[model samples]
Target: MNAKVRLGEFLLTRRSQLRPEDLGIPDYGERRRVPGLRREELASLAGVSVSYYTRLEQGQSLNASPQVLDAIARALRLEEAERLHLHNLARSSAADPGRRRSPAPERVTEATRQLLEALAHVPAILTGRRSDVLAWNRLGHALFAGHLDPGAPERPAQRPNMARLVFLDAHTRDLYADWPAKARAVVGHLRLVAGRHPDDTALHALVGELSAKSADFASMWADHRVMACTVATYRMRHPLVGPLTVTQQTLSQDPSLGQNIVVATTEADSPARTTLALLDQVTPQHGPARPTVRAGSG
Candidate 1:
């Protein structure tokens, strides 16, 4: 989809999620034709004329000033990440069409590989901008996807996408104790990425595939929520290690490359930490361990 269309959809969705009462506007208890604040009401709150705001929302106007966008973001009560996403969408919409090009294939640098080796004791996975698994340490592979081939990340065609696994793979779905929360976080993060890289064909394709394959994903995508999942704690049910809670932290070695190292760590002196140690021992130095039990089987 074009940036203008995406921007319009985002605006429409966010507007529908807000009520006049949310901004202290009097509703007067009259019957309403649609949910949330009307277009004129939102324009009034953003200090813009109704026709101008309507034009922006309809994708008829692409050259929106940053000040105007910021005003609309304020009126919408967007979070910090969401505000950034709004700006990104507006900027991309105004950019020249010829500037859009296919992204280059991502690679794991030697430095990144050395860093992963150093983090062998800890579970760490390196992912590209679209969350494609680029590399992982031995323990990381064992902790996250021991059921799959250990060399899958080395093959672009077979590389596992975090978003796809979360929604479509039964093993991944079973791994998370609170599946819905994880699903929402994945969708939100993808939405944020989409706004930032509107021209990324692979990312758009992934979104399309997920939306078609999973009704849950389709619903979540329509919600238009955006989030940056940097650090979050999740309770997981490992087939071999049983139940454990770990915090996943995303570290960027190079922001310009859009590659991130997601490290999973458990609290010291906790049972989860002990569980991880056991898994680490079983994980081979070269690759993931051979699982005695299949994930999602139990």
Candidate 2:
């Protein structure tokens, strides 16, 4: 993810979605080559010169001021996630071109492992930047990826990726009731992560692999949507548990690692809760007997 190119693409994608009338501007019914606001119109709305905005959009400008970026964000009608993504792109673009840093290790802390063990009653898993399952509780494995080997996450070379599973794995695809919506949300969140970690080589590789393998992923990737998955409800058709609705809550333990603890829950005394309890009864009470793991690229 080249930051300059990403910034330009983000701006272009967002700009192409808005129409003149949508921004309270008069439409003279001029035949324009592109949809949405023209460069001059966007610049005017953002309180900037057309030439300057053109330079920015062309990836020829760096060091965009915070005020200018904020103005452009408002002009584009960007949501909170999109606005943050734009700022992240701008910041990454301005970073020294020759500067380099080693990729941060994606490892679950011992403390987090303990927490995962403590939260034994709930379906929970830990995921890193590329949505690779770093670790998972017993119920999480049974609830989400029971078809795959339960010990996959322990093996670095074969770690299961949530996005890849959703888009490429047959079992995962069959698990969701609203597969398209789930796929879109996955791609959207990945866009936000890509903007924030522009230099992540592994992330680039993951995106490239998914784009090559899944037509759905390729299409969604091209959309350039940005989203953050803090909390979401999903309907799943588990082979063992039948239909269940789970509300997933994502919590961050370390910002620098870009890892999250994802825990799934159901409404009290609901059918989904009963189904989850049944699932618990079928699975082992203790954690997986083995510690095998899986990786996204493996």
Candidate 3:
């Protein structure tokens, strides 16, 4: 996945998604060959030469300024996240060529572990880029991945990916009543990661593995859906905790650790909350369950 190809593909997609009328361009009532704006029309809107836009779309001219990138983004009517992603992609390509890429994360810090331990009562987990449960609190372990061990070293390179579990693990599939929606979200998040980190060989490999293994994944990946799920309410059915309607909150990890911390909570007077309380009473203390952390499946 070369950055140029990704940039071009995204541009092409956005271009095709816009109708002439949507962009305030008058149509001549002729039958259209494509779904969206033509290349020349887009180039004209962005105030760039048609030949230059053609070259950029064809992955010939790799260098594009932030101003030019922003122009193209506005011309295509990109959303906030998409605009940021566009800049990130262009910036990544601007890095010195031939730098060895380290896609997979090795380890999170002890400070991060202490942070997780400090929030033992909250259902909080610090996840790597691939959604690897790097450090999870006791309540977090019980809430999201009940069967897994909380006290385990989840290095980015060596850990279970949450996306893999959603599709491959039977228990996880059963947990989500609307499994397809959740599945789409996982693929979408992975898609965003792929776009931002195209040089990430490990990410590419992970995506390849999932695409080959799950047909659902293959279909969604092909659709090119991309979104970041910062907040969501999940309907979960855990073996011990019964049914739960937990609202999830996501916050970015500190700069040193490029991860996200997810916290889940239920309404105070809800049955789900009561079930959580019961689960706490039954398993009050966090301990060293096993040497290894089993976050879903193979």
Candidate 4:
């Protein structure tokens, strides 16, 4: 969606989620036409006129100042991530489309490949901003996507998107013991990315495709939640190695490149750790021997 429309929808959705009682506003007995706070109520709370806030919410006003956006965010009780997203949307909505640069095709640099090789014993997958699998080490491939072709990430056209896998691929869906939590995290992070890169055609296309194909994804997307996929603990039901708990931590490779390295680790000397070690041993060594590495996929 365009930045203006996205900003409007986000504002409307968040407005609908709050009640007058949520912010200590006394409600008199009266018939209501819709849910949550009205535009007048929100405008009053944000210290703006109703007409201005209405214009903003209707996508007619795109030049909101940072102070005004911050005020609106405070009135809506937005979290840190959601507040950042609000500012991003507002900026994009005001930006000239002709001046925006098209995103470059994402690639894993040699330096990144060397880092992956250094973490060969650990489960590590490199992913792009839109959650596309750029590359992975042996254990990383086995832990996350052993069902798919091990070399799929080597080809851009064949790269697996983490969001798509979580919602649309049965194997990935089954891998997570608490599937709903994983699904929400993926959607939330995707929402944040969408706000940040409003001009990203491929990213928007992926969102549209997933929304059309999966009811679950559509519902989650409509919720307008935002999250950073920094560190999360998940229980995985690996087909070969059975159940194991691991903490997945995402490390940014480069902010300008919009690539991140996701590493999965288990607790020290735990059964999960032993299971991971077993998985490492059983996972075939692809290409050249690790530590000296060869090009591969996730």
Candidate 5:
């Protein structure tokens, strides 16, 4: 996706989400054709000319100052994550256009592998920038993708992408009690990454693939929402272990790695914890019974 177009879409989406009444603008009972505040109204509130705001939203204004972006962000009432995303999108577009860089190879370091191994009982997976499962512990495999071939992550062609699984894989979809919420979170996090890594071709390809395959993904992508997922609680239904609630924490290893270790844990002494322990017992420590990571089908 082009960075300018992304910035424009982000601005447009956020603008439409804010209602005039919420921002103390009097509507005067006028029949409105557009949702939320009009372009002029937003520009007025943001202390900018309507023409300038329009140019920014049309991708014509590439040199937006940080102060100007912040003013617009305030007018739109964007959350902290969304505000950061807006700045990233603008900054990406403002960078030297002549230079280009290839996406980094997605791989888990030996040290990260050792970390996953140390947390044998915890359902934990190491993911690359595209949410590709680079590696996972035995328990994580059993908990998240037990139906797929366990050795799939070892093959780059067969690595399972969490975003793809959330939207397209029926087994993974069924595992989540709140499937829609999970899907939205995936899209939001992907948007955040897209803003920060605008030159990532792999990410753009993944987004294209998902947009073509899943209507839900397409709609969410069009909305241009942005989010950084650090911690979340989710309800999951395991075929073997029944229902359980787990909190997922995303830990960043190295800044340059662009990878996260997603670890899921249940409450202490809770029934879900007991169920997870049982799952660990039934799942082999190291063997042919590993979790399968299938290539997502279109």
Candidate 6:
């Protein structure tokens, strides 16, 4: 959780990935002893002394400036998200003692709910930081968790996670036609979440449970893979309906709950769209009303 250690691990991981030629470093046979750029090479690239870089990598250095972090990030070729994570790790290191940062509260704001209502035609749901289903449009329930209790409002305690459903729930397993692809995404998403919320107790608990209960999940989790998934397309086989080519987009609500709003939409005039519309029409009439009083707005 400490910045220096996180930075070191990140640098180590990234360094192991690039070869000498990849960074224009001459590599004569017997000139290299390790797989990645050495500490000296990395320090040279970042315009830092070998001793300083070594100390940082060993978690002995603290309070790394943003400028130094940027240099290191560039040296390691970190992505934007990774760079941000690096900054977060560094900045959080200097947190004042006795200061407790409560977990970021998650909720569905009135405006967000209105937006969902407006996009009622699309299958959309708002999820918390832990991937807890917070709220869903009528079609969203049908598209994703149609079998769950529609009457039960999406909340932190009662909400079913998309990752849990994809990997842990048998009903969800059967719901996805291309289960393997969906499974990879689930793990990748979890990886991304873990990287961001390394201190999230609930997230760690979820990961531990999934790793213990599901062998497939355990296998993927060991790979140490991380990815930021904002959009994806998938082929899903709905039991009530049939195959669907759906595109998933994740929206973040700022100054609210930071909840991720994921919406799945089919191609224009596609059978899936028609099926979704039909589902929306039939679901509310047949099932109980979806509970609205779930999260505390405050």
TM-score of each: 0.94, 0.95, 0.84, 0.93, 0.94, 0.81
lDDT of 5 by residue, 27-46 (tens): 89998898978999999999
lDDT against the true structure, each candidate: 0.90, 0.90, 0.77, 0.91, 0.89, 0.75
- Weakest lDDT window of 10 consecutive positions for candidate 3: 149-158
Give the candidate number with the greatest lDDT.
Answer: 4
Candidate 5 accuracy as TM-score? 0.94
Distance from true position, residue 166, model 2, in Å?
0.8
Tens-digit per-residue lDDT, 1-298, candidate 4: 6788999999999999998888988878876789889999999999999999999998999789999999999999999999999999999999988899989999878899889889988999999999999999888889999988877898889899999999999999999999999999999999998888888889999999999999999999999989888899999999999999999999989888678999999999999999999998898877323233457833
Off by over 4 Å in 6: 1-4, 31-34, 173-198, 215-225, 271-275, 278-298
Cα lDDT tens digits, model 6, 1-298, are 4445655676677777667787898867666667888889989999999998888778777788899989988898777766776676666555554564557667667897788778867888877776788777777888888889864554356778888888888888987778887888778667666555556777888988899999999988665445566888887777777777888888776523447889998788988778766766776744325444558754
Clashing pairs in 4: none
Summarize candidate 2's per-residue lDDT along 5-45 as a digit string, tens digits: 88998899889989888889987767878888899999999
* Residue clash pairs of candidate 3: none
RMSD of each: 6.3, 3.9, 4.9, 3.4, 4.8, 3.8
lDDT of 4: 0.91
Instruction: State which candidate, 2 or 5, has the greater TM-score.
Output: 2
Q: Tell me the deviation in Å of residue 182 in model 2.
A: 1.0
> In model 3, what lDDT does residue 218 have?
91
Q: Candidate 3's residue-wise lDDT over 58-91, tens digit each?
A: 7777668888988998998887777877776666
Report the candidate with higher lDDT, 3 versus 4: 4
| lDDT tens digits, residue span 189-222, model 1 | 9998888888898889999999999999999999
